[model samples]
Target: MNDHIAPPTAAPAPALQPVRAAGIATMTALALAGLGWAARGVWQIRLAMAGEPASGPPDQGGGVHRPLTSLEDSYHLVTTVSGFAAAVCAIAFLVWTGRVRDNARELSGTRPRYSGLWVYFGWVVPVVNLWFPRGIIADAYRASAPGERLPRSLNVWWGLWLIGMLSGVGLMYGDNTDEIIARAYAHVWQLLASDAAVVGAAVAGIFVVRAVTAVQERHLDEP
Candidate 1:
């Protein structure tokens, strides 16, 4: 007769529902604010370029010389704030993603691992930053997906974002345009395209946050 005793089972990990909810809330708020700010900035820039006079101090000689106006100033401020908020949200999501990935790995009794910010930062650096971030974002989506099947709409939205980014960067930094023609029409289209992309990204971002929360809950509730 064997007298060996079985080892006690380990307690399940605590639920992270509250953290998940908070992350979702923060991400949504920041993303919305950021996107809104960017949209406003684009509109203001377009308007200013279309011969709208500045709202600040008049030119030295009292003639309204259409300098960058108060609207542009406010737009810049908004963009700055939005960028900061977005960065904060990104960091929070990164932390949440890392925790989720780690937990999942641990549950599978495998070594824990998490993706890095380089995936997202690939867009902000320089030349490589232009397109690398897109691939990185795709990779991230795949890694985060439950069954390796990313939503088709995400691809569409990202395609728009990439186009907008390329166009915006070109408008802002390119030098091969016909200055007169570009001044009349190109700038407006560029701003509109970029803002449209921002809107698309914001919508997709909402879905992503919701998905993250759902995954978090599922993982937390798993026995």
Candidate 2:
């Protein structure tokens, strides 16, 4: 009878199934949202290049362009929801990584050297933030692996995103605006390419990392 009172097992750490599923859903949604936003921006760029304003009061000439109010409303809704979901996913990933770190520490009999706060810094800082997050993620994955080799796909994706960010920044802020709206339209086209590449790479990385993490969690449950 006394043995029946053995301490209650901490509810088996919440299953990774739900977390992984939510992450996949979020990544897919976020990728689609980013692609949609890019398409909208591209359309606006085309219109602007045709001598229409990127955004301003509707002209009196009965231009074929859609009404400003309708456009604004659509833009607001898409951006708001997409941004919210992405933010939630980012926080969730941080939490998941922290859990992995803690589990590793317990198994190895060593202290965890990192935490969720470190993940936040990777996005919040200006220059270092871009590369820092990738490094941290890669490191985490490596730690979770039985050996230190990281998959080449992860490095390729991270590199492309970093390049995209650099190129986008250069195209947007790197020159005098003396050429008027036409130049602005050109800039918009350039920026669209850069942003699409960056966001696409991020989505791919998330999917791969999520799978890797899930496997790591399962392996840890054994022995």
Candidate 3:
């Protein structure tokens, strides 16, 4: 009778964190940032064609630099604001990823391949940054929904992110407007390419987030 106290039932799944809200937040930020970059790309090309100042106009005889044209001023303002927003977007994304990761562990009752800290540092550290971010997400997906094949959007997003970061397309940002415009002189094509890659990655990332969130939601509902 003592041995019959319910012959060892399976362990219950750990408590799951809500994933949809985080997923939605991440997707929205990504979409906005992506659109901003796309607009900036077009604006930059137009500015380049319109003869942006290479040396801030002819220096006044009094040694004062001429004021920036309205167009140039606008570009600087837009880029500065956009750059700041990108930083914010990064934080939001990490938060969402962490949320999903935590829930994944709960749902599967297995340890993630990477430690929790990797969710942030893994994206910035050299070498490991190349694969860690993708791997972390993939591992979470697998753990939360075992046996299902990974989604195609995951690979697409990762690929575009790598291309944008590694191909010198990242030279588009700088501390000053002059520097920003100057860097585009010989690498306009690369800058545009990077923008396109980032935009595409953002779109793919939305899908990946959706898929992961959806599966985890479904898994959490299982009896």
lDDT at position 193, candidate 3: 85
The clash count for each model shown is 0, 0, 0
> Residue-wise lDDT of candidate 3 within 12-88, one digit each (tens)?
66788888788888888888878877877877787768764656433334656567677767877778777776777
Per-model lDDT: 0.53, 0.55, 0.80
- How accurate locally is residue 215 in candidate 3, as Cα lDDT from 0 to 100? 91
Better of 2 and 3 by lDDT: 3
lDDT of 3: 0.80
Q: Estimate each model's TM-score.
A: 0.61, 0.62, 0.87
* Model 2 lDDT tens row, 1-223: 8987888776444332223554465556546645654654554465455554455434333543345444444544544555565566566656665555554544444444555566667666798777777666665565566575777767776776676667756443453222222343445566566656766666666665565566566665664
Better of 1 and 2 by lDDT: 2
Off by over 4 Å in 2: 1-26, 29-33, 36-42, 45-77, 113-115, 167-186, 220-223
TM-score pick, better of 1 and 3? 3
Tell me how far the alpha carbon of residue 175 in candidate 3 is from the true structure, in angstroms, after superposition.
6.3
